[model samples]
Target: MTTYYRDGDVVITSTGIRMHGREYALAELRQVWHRSGRRSWGTIAGRGVLGLAMLLPILVGALGVGIALVAHASVAVTAGLVGGGILVGLAAAPLADVLLERVDRSYDRGSRRREIWGRTRHGDVLLLSTADAARFGRIYRALQRALEPSRVTR
Candidate 1:
């Protein structure tokens, strides 16, 4: 007969490491504490904002052209308005790209920790090297004990 130790709210590994939250597949790990979060949504929102900002210049140009067409204004005036819009859109593209890159880098740096291991909503996993196994074990044990249910009910 095989006896399986079912975890009751808390699960500990054979190495005395306490498992917290949902466990992720090892293959899914990209970097220490840095994982993609709602990337598709962010991409869509970013594009939408940039598109809206770009449309402002086009709209202004269209209004100017409409006025010129209706009032028999000079062709130079209409062309200048449209050209200005194009120039503004062109400048915005690079600015938007730079802003997005900075945001992504900030998020990546914020998620990283200098500690041997860190805990997040995802799960608690050891990030220490072989040389620090003993120290890691001590911390793991401490965390496990803290997570365990209290024996004395209040």
Candidate 2:
């Protein structure tokens, strides 16, 4: 069988598609279409919220130190607060990194996602769903190319 697309166990071939251990025969697909919509944002943004939670106490402490400095507090107390806040902020760096990474991914993944669907003898079926637009485009185009040979008149 000629493989139009192959990625791990998921494949598109002359005969059909095999993904997630499910098989779909190409002959059974009468028509195919694409769908795009928003993805669930809560999970990604939630991490940022949690990060904000973690940093709030640090921020409040810093603000208190600033006020103390402005009010001519003793040098030893100001120095201690500055030193402690630095240590705590440094200690929380990894969690802050995670928060920033999640925020970046949310932007990269964007608001919309893509899906492929096909009409078959039994009914309509979902062929693929992904947040990765590049992969989706590649697979969808491959499916189109694989089906094209059958549609041409000899």
lDDT string for model 1 (1-154, tens) is: 1111224333333223223454432233333331222234554465566667656655665665566556655678767766665665566667656666755544444322234344434665554422223333454444434334322111
Tell me the TM-score of each prediction against the true structure: 0.31, 0.61
lDDT of 2 at 90: 67
State how far residue 42 of model 1 sits from its true place (Å): 16
Off by over 4 Å in 2: 2-9, 20-22, 37-41, 44-61, 103-114, 121-123, 129-145, 148-154
Tens digits of per-residue lDDT for model 2, 1-154: 8989999756999988886687888777788888997766775567568778668756866765666567666888778777776666565667667767776666656556888888878887887888876778788888888778666211
Deviation (Å) of 98 in candidate 2: 2.7
TM-score: which candidate is best?
2
Segments in model 1 whose C-alpha atoms lie over 4 Å from true places: 1-72, 110-154
Worst 10 residues of 2 by lDDT: 145-154
TM-score of 2: 0.61
